[model samples]
Target: MGSRRTFSRRLGVPGRAGVALFAAGLGLMSPFAAAPASAQTADAPAGTWATPPPLGPGDAPPADSGHPDTTYKKKNECVQRSLGQDVKINFRPWGQDYLQLDRAQQIVRAATGSVGGNQKVAVIDTGVTPHPWFQDRVESGGDYVATPDNGAQPGMQDCDGHGTEVAGIIAGNPKDPQVGFIGVAPDARIVSYRQLSENYAKDDSPQQPSAPPSGGTGAPPSGGESQQPPAGGSSNSQLPPSSGGGTGSGSGTAPQQDNKGDSRDLAKQGTAGTLNTLAQIIRGIADTHRAGVINMSVDHCRPGTAPGDIQEGERKVQAAVRYAADNDIVVVAAAGNVSENCPQNDQADPNKPKSIVTPPWFSDDVLSVGAIQEDGGVAPFSVHGPWVGVAAPGTKIVSLDPAEHSNGLANLTIANGNPSPIQGTSFAAPYVAGVAALVRSMFPHMKARDVVKRLKATAQHPAAPGGRDNFVGYGVIDPVAALTANLPGDTGNLSLPKPVVQEAKLPPADGISSTPMIVALAGTGGGVAALLITLFVMHTIRRNRARSSPPTK
Candidate 1:
């Protein structure tokens, strides 16, 4: 009923005690409560605060209760342009000001002035429209959702509005003077890949035949919840923390026990998206040199599986990410938003995450990113995990609209015809991706691993002693510092102070003479005692005199 129902688009936190606590502090409505951005008023009392309700484009209504057939159909169609796909703004969004990108840009401009001019970032999610902000920088890598017409660009059309926004965060450069929000790397190039979309899901009857496509634990946040996937979300195979796992962005609705047989089979056959396609997509990006960095805001989430029971599709994804890393490409992805389907990874042990979201769970090869609010706290909907490499401003998003006609920036998206603000880690991954671009541009010779390490090292680490935590990892990213900070990895990093050698010295000895001290102590004590004795004798004599004279009284 809301904006385009997208499986790749996550909503908010679960409807648990955590949401209630978060709402009580903020004076929000029920966990299930959701409102459009237009519903909020700026005129709340001075001491109070007002904000938009969490908007989840992925929250789908329940599927049919009837026994659905396992032989589901898959098709491809172009995502049509929509009227409310974007909301224009004459001012900058909080994220830009929060990160202070303008100042960072100024600093970099004065030095290398390489604001990603030589960088290319690949966005694998819903397709991106050719927005005005992109100018001539947006490119079509390929499409998994819709079969391209002979002349149409496969990955140029964005129906879900997800990938377009993600790319905007990385490379949008508007011509307008009034709009303050521009891409982090305004000069960088963007390659769009449409790998997932809700619009291309099930139909009562099969229409035109086409090819198929792919693909925290901190506490329960307020808006994220497990809504039924728009297309069938059930999976035939899934594993748990200790054993292994499957791949998808988030988990699907567990089929009810009574309907398990039919629902499970139907889910397996459901044509939502697949990890197999996601794997292929990454390999495609790596092999063709389409981009040096990849932003995958979309992930595969499923119920945990046994420790050693990794699925075939998941193994392929793991191998593909490894392959990318070996080729010296940086992969950045969302940490995931918490909900019933996808549990938070708040466990003390890193490996024993309550839920596993891959590419992210594959921490060594991927730079998993978490979302933080404008206030800098981890977003309530942002799920915590050991794999989180860094955090960025994910809420109160302002970016170019994917609608081909809108050609403007948006702070609000249409959810059920109501204005809803864009908030999710889906957008957060791009911030790091954008920063990665800036880093690679600044240091042309830096390797991919070092780039990942630099971003983490330059990040504002958490309060934890290790400078990292499950919640925010190394902490919120500082792009200005990332561009300018010197590191051990820097070959010319001689700015560090040289070690100073010091002569070892013994403890100071007591120097005063004991004889003088003893004499002074003896003299002082004798004088006091003599004075007391003299006073006692005098008092005795005076008492005797008074006794003789007391007869008269």
Candidate 2:
């Protein structure tokens, strides 16, 4: 009977037009057809010029998706050890080199005495773990991703090591010489806001049973989709295998239960409340009036989508950005690791071409950062568009790691330890944020808008067309320039020259017109003589008249 059913299914193949219609219905055909010739090149390398893979279970939602996209390099492939005894003590991350931090430090010291001193930087990500490097400077801003079961205290813990890495990049102090990694702004204070949950959705709602494809039986497949473990954690090996049992010999078979309901509930428990929670937290930060810069290394990139109209969640984030801006807080966000345009919302909307992503795309007030390689080229995975404000060193960036693994084991191996190196726009945003802190520290009276303007104006324009392309925006951030360079603000006025009073120049002696001068002088003298003669005649007449008048008196 099974063989007969399979044979019958094989006889019902769809025509080419039917296949085309199905592809169009899914909105897949247009993206491929409309893709540029460069993207469609058959000879292109495997990972280059390709759309990023779809988001998976371990990934955060679109709001906090600024985590590294490891399509180019696997997580294990990018690991590095902390500097050892024989290693040089002055080892610096490529990002620091790109920003010219040494020169910036000298300039900053000459001007402000220290780098990012007394400035508060708020890192909004997974909670930062307490590490020796940031022990004295780290402050808790409370966890926004807390669930009923997990409570809010765990929000301060770095379950996935992402937040710790980001915070370390911004302001990890160089206290431990053994771990020779230093943040861009070593003296800056860090305030952590834990917003992303450590776990992913466990199960998805089941699809209705459909007819089996050719050569397959009607029985449902065993097991659900495999879940990848979150970064820096081991896999969950205890999850039960999906039920696929059947009954025999007239015994009725009980249908296998699905975890769809449980999955939905878990998702609600974890992420349903994130948008409002994040918005409130941002407002709270602004209300504090302490944070000089807020480093939001998170971004949302919808899968299989082009940039489209704004969604409600994105609008809420934009409002929060506006709130931060209104309160004089500089907000810096990742440009996302997805290699599409910014502001990609709906994958199914054919009218929307690939563009920039939001909340950075939503407002020019926000600084949207892209990633660049050591050679100063845009990283293949860095998202691009007009909304991007600047690029930073994101590839192979070395920073702090969580102190321990989720299993309570120390997060150290013989080959590598706490100074874990990562790469993404996530880390890139912090570099810019650190620079912003330095700017704010140096110019305490400068407004948030002026600080943002200084960062962009002093950025090193790349060698691309227009000097500012969609890939790297204005170009890689120059920390020294941001610190020392004089930049114009949004309302920067030109310094006009003062009005000058010029004395009239006399002609050379040989070039003077002597004839006209003599004529003028002689005419003046003749006129004066005539006047004198008339006056004398009048006086004589008056004397004779006076004599006559005296006789009459």
Among these predictions, the greatest TM-score belongs to: 1
Clash pairs, candidate 2, are 62-300, 307-344, 341-355, 342-355, 342-356, 342-357, 343-356, 343-357
Per-candidate TM-scores read 0.65, 0.57
Kindly report which residue stretches of model 1 are placed more than 4 angstroms away from their true locations once superposed.
1-87, 149-151, 202-271, 347-350, 491-553
lDDT by residue (511-545, candidate 2, tens digit) is 66699989999999999999999999999999998
Residues 1-553, candidate 1: write the lDDT tens digits: 2332331134354435444555554533321122222211101112211111121354222221211222223332222222322334667777888888998777666767557888999998767778777888988887765554324487776644567778999999985677778999998999988676543455556565544332200000011211111111123322211111011122232221110001111012334445666777888777777799999887765555545445556666777787788788999988777655666666555445566666676676788888888888888778776567789988777777554455666554332222235677877889999999888877777888888878877888665634566778777889988888877646332254556998899889788779998999999999999999999999999999988885764
State which candidate has the highest lDDT. 1
| lDDT, residue 269, model 2 | 29
**Model 1 lDDT at residue 474:** 75
Per model, state how many residue pairs clash.
Answer: 35, 8
